[model samples]
Target chain A: MLIATALASVFIRDLFAVIMVFGIYSLLSAGFFLNLNAPDVALTEAAIGAGIAPILMLGTLALTRKKWDPEPHAKKSTHTPLLPLIVVAITGAALVYATFDMPYYGDAEAPSHTHVAPRYIQESGQEIDIPNMVTSVLASYRGFDTLGEVFVIFTAGIGVLALLGFLSDGSGRKYWQFADTASLRRHTVLHVIAKILIPLILLYAFYVQFHGDYSPGGGFQAGVIFATAFILYTMISGLQAVYKIIKPELIYWTMAFGVMLYGVTGLVAMFMGGDYLDYNALDHHDPIHGQHMGILLVELGVGICVAAVMMSVFFNFAGRGIRLPEDTKEGGQ
Target chain B: MSVVLGLFNYWIVIALMMTGFYLVIATSNLIKKIIGLNIFQTSVFILYISIAKVKGGAAPILEEGTELYANPLPHVLILTAIVVGIATTALGLALIVRIKEAYGSIEEDDIREKGGTT
Candidate 1:
């Protein structure tokens, strides 16, 4: 089923249908992850693959709608298929050939099974005292990689801001025209449902935020759901309504702050006479408790940064006022 | 037959990956390329996960008296990878929008015809 969706996306010339099919492709992959016993990954994949990717794509479509002709005749491919087909076939064959010597799926005696994974599985309980090994590995053990991941997200946010200019469309003028309250007031059903659901989603985000050590969620999932709640709010009430409630400056600073918080946590550990990002030295007297402190702060940092980035990206994509044909040249006319 | 059956998951994953590869290079549309990149990304993910599975193991969340558990390492890496993928895709889509604004078209040849290299 997942492969079918992907193939459909590849064959479907219409961008809108491709994006929708891509969403289902992601959702099915999430199900596949669950079947393989990677719930931590499954949670993040579902949130991202189905929820945020489509929203951003749709927003891009809305802005670029004026550029593309809707007529089917405009969808013809200009590239020849022969070279690309040969390349793809060769790559696929090489990949499959490489897998021949690999241990069959799920074999207990496989190289990976005998390596560091078992150590993380067996000793983490004693060392980190955390029930969720993925969280401990992510937020505590391999802290540097997660830090890099956070910065990647932060960098993307900055890139988008430079390109699209979030709050005023990178210029000083009012970007959106219809931020008027009538947009939300016109749809009472949407308003009522969102009013009831947004708070609950926010509350659940907090649960995932704080309970990551014991469960399948951590900052990434929590931050995604948190930002998603705001995205939902924006969708229902319009981007202007969200800006009214949550200052755009606050969101921008929060993105920077989340990354900083992660850095500060590592620096504080360094100041305490331990290596950078060594959470064991966070509370030297009680190392487990120190691990707890480190993981919580880092996860909080991740959550805060991710939530801010997601919301800002959505706003930048959705906030571009209406794109007009005259707005095309070197500068906005 | 059993040899093929035993390794079917890996083979199927390869086929899925090439589907993405074909879309990316065979098509001229910018959005389709992004979607192809996404499909290619998922194949790698499914690769990591299927390799991590243990026949009798439970999910990586530690529970009392649960002896066997799937590998937690790949799960950790893929978790971050998934988010980074979205971040990069967002960046790609943003660039595509900018291209549309500047070139007035998203087709690669069309952009190139207008003297803007895709």
Candidate 2:
């Protein structure tokens, strides 16, 4: 079913069908992760694949709205397919050949299973003092990698901001003129349902944020969920209503603040004479308590940055698609 | 033959990966290319996950009487990767929105002809 949807999405020329099929493919992959016993990953995949990815794609479709013309354009530049085909075939063959040496699916003796993993499972209770080994590994053992991931998200947000600009930027007003807001307002069912559902989603996001130490979720998933709630609100209420509530400038500040919080936590540890990202330095009297505090603060930093970045991205995209009536009243020449 | 049977899941993922790779290269539409990229990425994810499984293992949560558990490392790594993937996809789509605005069409040939590069 996954392969079928993926193939359908690729071959389909109609952008709407392609996006829908992609959403199905994402949901199916989430199911696949569940089967693999990776609930945390499965949850992220479902949220990202089913929830956020489609919303973003639909937003793009709205902006573009280029009909799929079956008839090829007269000036369609000639593209050679032979080279790309050969490249793909060779790459595929090499990847398959390499897999022959890899341990068979579910083999306990696999190198990945034998190394570091066993220790994490066995020692995490004492070292990280967390029930969820994945959280312990993510927030503590490989904390540095997660730090890099947060910055990568931040960089992407910065890139989008530079391209799309803020919602209130005067220079973007011309593009905003073409934005179609009346269509978004037509769905009252969605509006009413969203009004009921958005608060619950925000509450759940906070649960996932703090409960991550004992469960399958953490700051990353929590942030995405929080951002999704806002994206939903923006979809139904129109970006204008959201703008009145939360300024675009506040989102930018929050985005920077999240990353800075993560960095400063590490610096505080160093000043306390522990290595960077060492949570133990946060509370010298009780090292375990310090680890707890550090993880909480770090995850809080991650959640804040991720939620802000995702919100800003959605706002930037949504802002690109809608024109305020006031803009016409003021700028229509 | 038995070894081949044991590893059949890996082979299927490889096939899926190739299909995605083909679509990415063969498709002319920019959005379709992103879809293809997503398929290719998810296939790699399946590969990581399939290898993470231990035949009799349980999910990696600390509890009494659970001896064998799936490797938590891949789960953690892939969780981060999934977030990064969505971020990348968001950026790509944003670029597509801008491309359509500037080039007036997201078709590769149209963009290539208009701007001499896609």
DockQ, per-model, please? Answer: 0.80, 0.70
DockQ agreement of candidate 1 with the native complex: 0.80
* Predicted candidate 2 versus true structure: per-residue lDDT over B34-102, tens digit per residue: 878888899889888888888889888898899999999999999989988988888999899888877
Off by over 4 Å in 1: A67-77, A166-185, A321-333, B116-118
lDDT of 2 at B3: 74
Tens-place lDDT per residue, model 2, A1-333, is 887887687567677888898899899999999898898999899989898888888877777763445535556446556777798789878977887887888889988888899999999889778888889888888889999999999999998887766444555453333544635677878778988999999999999999999988999999999999988887777766777788878989999999999889899999998999998888989888989988998899999999999998888777776643444456556
Residue A85 of model 1, lDDT score: 90
Q: Is the docking of candidate 2 incorrect, acceptable, medium or high quality?
A: medium
What is the lDDT for B116 in model 1?
44
Note the residue pairs that clash in candidate 2: none
Say which candidate scores most in lDDT. Answer: 1
Candidate 2 residue runs with Cα over 4 Å from true position: A66-83, A166-182, A323-333
